[model samples]
Target: MQARKTIIRLFTTFLQFDSDKAIGWVTDGRLRRNIVNSQVYSSEIENSENFWVTYWYKQWQDNPKSLAKEHLLAYLQETCYWVASKTVKNIYSPQYTVSDCFQMMIARTDKVLKGFKPEMGFGLKNYGSAIFSSELKELLRQEQEIDICTNWRLLRKLTQKRLTESLENIGMNSKIIERYILAWKCYQMLYTPTQRTGTRKLQKPTLQTWEAIAELYNNQRLKQLPTNTPECSPEIIEKWMVASAKAVRAYFYPSHISLNVPHGNSEASRELIDDLPGDEEKSPISQIVIQEEKLAREVQQDRIKSVLLTALEELDEESRKIIQLYYGAELSQQQIAKKLEMKQYNISRRLSKSREVLLYKLAAYCKESLHISLNPPVLDYISTLMKEWLKLKFNPPTSEMEN
Candidate 1:
């Protein structure tokens, strides 16, 4: 009977039975006898409110040899299916499977459980849930960030291809072309890959930055060259480095490049098209042009609102709660601080920072996914419109007011 009840509990865990059902079965006299007989389950079930702890303990004990090698793999698999389920839904890419999340959760949970003690007075389920959920959220956040970085890498490759083709068309010298490519590589490395938003904050690359890149490049070339070959002079290397730095600075800043002054050829214009937003080609003069333009702008405003709502989901839970209370509930910063037991200044600062982060993310999304730029003025308009939309969404008009 004890063995039969133990089998039933194992099946219940595998099938993911609801807590009440599992608890009912676990607290039954027969199941309690099985749990009492299982020495590993006795300690965990002593003060537990639910059956999950005993079930998890049983699973862990049943696979003691596997546990010795893999630690929490069996235990987490029995206990944390919900963690994998939730993580899978949040991951932006389809490439990651639920099994991948499960493996990651097991690894993270093993590390966390190493520090856990029975005397801590917290149930394993509660502690494990908190740790696993937090780690899973961070993992999902990184996956989203990686998706953004991957898109930026593709953008860089496409830009490099276009620049190469354009320079070749102009009949540029091979050495100069190499210098230009080297300069572009230096420029790319000056900023970290993850922060390469279209409207990223720009800083002028210093001479030291160029020198470091040049030294690294020279060392790599020295490694590949045969010992019999004469090394390039310091003077020649310095000259190449200077030229590469100049080319990179020009490519990124382009302060001297004039978009307003029309270049004579199609190739010049095509080069500009990829770097600058293309000007809309003129269509036949029509009487409804003004109305069409107005309608288009309205459609764009609607899209911005939709995108803002989607971006809100990316914010952390605390930030999301503040946004909901302040924007959705129409609470002031002071009122929100009071309700949340935080400083008024902190509340105000969080709201300001959250808005800025959201706008930056929104701009990046528009540039990457929609092939549109969200300039300062456009972002300002969208921010105002989003607030108004949120008000309508959350604080609907009363029936009496509607009448």
Candidate 2:
């Protein structure tokens, strides 16, 4: 049997908090208590989730200092954890961790909330899941960049302010930091990696290279720092450089937070339970509920696809060609303009206008068929979804094309 969706329980369990602790995080205790007790986080009770989301969001907007803000954030964090867990799915490495991506999603909550409109008919979790997925992709890109960079390349890329802050974070005194920075400057000036290729795999400086760097540092320290500062040995310079690289790496990587503990508390965390709320057994009713949800999702997806297909068919030939060239052929605006004998800006304008028209149709479909309200946020979200769908629909795989 398929397992019941336990997103809420998973959230609370990862938080290492019980319903009481969760309630304590909120100012409006009564509402939170009602939610926890009723377990309205299930698919059947989705409207309950929507209500609390809009209610707490309003509280936050009305008063930035409102205690209900905590509740609002916690609710959104549930969506973040859900998306992050699904995206990462136990695939951890030195470069990426679930907690790290979760942190990135949490960081984007403000931007996500700012762009969310409850009037749009989509639930907050649904909205947040899309943005969180994008943020995770960006995090992955950054991690990949850092992962591939050698220590030398990483340090070379880091700004002086970042280096200073990193050294300071490790409790280095200002004077020592200054000496380290001066040594680094001398090394940068003197030590050049002999092997120059496209790869980031720069080998460590040889002993002779380190000695040259030390000689330069010794000669320049008197000019750069306090006149009486002692000259450093090659070993000390090498040690400082290695330590600086370590500091940069430590500062760049996301801090590992324990999922089993609540934020800001050091006490022992609560343990997970075997049974989720409201569904103890694989009963026929539970199975029916799950199937209904699955069916509803399929229905909604089909409706969206139908609306998009009709809208595309109704578009003008030129607009259709523009979309096909841009999304299907994956051509740049300039390239499309060149091939079509039009100005680049004209191609850009046509693409924008085409998107707007398609988005408007989708928004109308949402109102007429899906019973969703028309709002700027809703239109923006529909635009994102429409663009993604168009890209996927237009851009079939090479093998499929060949067939």
Candidate 3:
């Protein structure tokens, strides 16, 4: 009760509203019910959450900076809080508190709202929670890379554009940036972690590895850079690599954006909103692809089931049991490990491996059978489709089981 009041108070202050008015507006029954009554079915009035969502969502679409949008986001703070609580428990990272995660989720309000569709048969909060979870998980995964990896691994993962930006951010000259990029490229090619090295904890390069990287950089420097440039020794290479890592780390640290600030001037805001999906006119190919995807979804559910079943059959007995226990029995990884007398980490890895198998099979089926191009969006679609199938297959609805 006290926590809710605190959030309400903060929301009021953040929006610069009178405390009494804020309370009244949030509690207003007529605004919640009457406005959406005509839009929703008669049956949905009893639970007016979706109605309120539809009400303010429409207003937000009409104007992103409107008070209606602010009110809508404020209303959904409880929903966002619920998600953040569960996320903190699951992720259990020392670096991120519940407040930190909640703020991050709030920062992504535009993205969450952009992905919601009333016609999709999901409530706004439900869809928003899923998006928030996925986005948060990806963010944490990136943070994990930064947290656990050595300088060499960090350098290896940095994209050319990122490395250039980091170097330029730190006031490095163009020529110096070019040299660092080439040196990092050579380092990436030579300093490979051993197979036993986990993805999360990449071992630092050995002296021999650094020497080899320096040798490679020396050999390639003249070809890539001016002949007058000095050849870099192992010590010089290590120093540059450390500097690059620090710069990349500083540049890529997460920064949360607040909702209170204006997005931009009207024209730029319009352009930003125009870039959202389904806002602008898509090309002919895009239209056909969208149509084909919709049609395929309607028809391909059963085909995907069969394809996934075949793929599951390919799994080893242990992997099969792990999937069954995790999905069918709906057990946590720790519980599954306890039951099977396996290590918890082993259980986690197997579960991931099982998903990878299913994902691969689903992608292949989409390409070979459905003839869908395996683009990122299409792959993501297939992955989601596969998960839905697995959930339904392993744990059918209670009504279906009874029937």
Best by TM-score: 2
Q: Report the Cα RMSD per candidate.
A: 26.6, 12.2, 11.1
Ranking by lDDT: 2, 3, 1
Tens-digit lDDT track of model 3 for 278-362: 2211111233333344444445655766778999999999999999888677689999999999999999999998999899987
Candidate 3 has its poorest 10 consecutive residues by lDDT at 15-24
For model 1, how does the per-residue alpha-carbon lDDT over 1-403 read when each residue is reduced to its tens digit? 1111243343221211232111111222323333344434334333322233433333444443322212233233444555565456554456555545545565565544553332222345444654675676676664444334332243243356645654565567765666555545544665344454553333433456556656655555455544453434434544544444334333322222211224557654532212332122122123144334434544655666667777777778888889889856767888899999999999988888888777776667667755656677555544544454554456543322000
Which candidate, 1 or 2, has the higher TM-score?
2
Mark the regions of model 2 whose C-alpha exceeds 4 Å error after superposition: 1-70, 81-100, 103-131, 148-150, 157-179, 218-231, 261-403
Flag clash pairs in model 1: none
Error of 2 at 160 (Å): 3.9
Q: What's model 2's lDDT at 222?
A: 76
Each model's lDDT: 0.47, 0.64, 0.64
Worst 10 residues of 2 by lDDT: 274-283
Off by over 4 Å in 3: 2-72, 90-95, 157-181, 192-240, 255-330, 333-403
For candidate 1, the TM-score is 0.31
Stronger candidate by TM-score (2 vs 3)? 2
Error of 2 at 353 (Å): 8.4
Better of 1 and 2 by lDDT: 2
Ranking by TM-score: 2, 3, 1
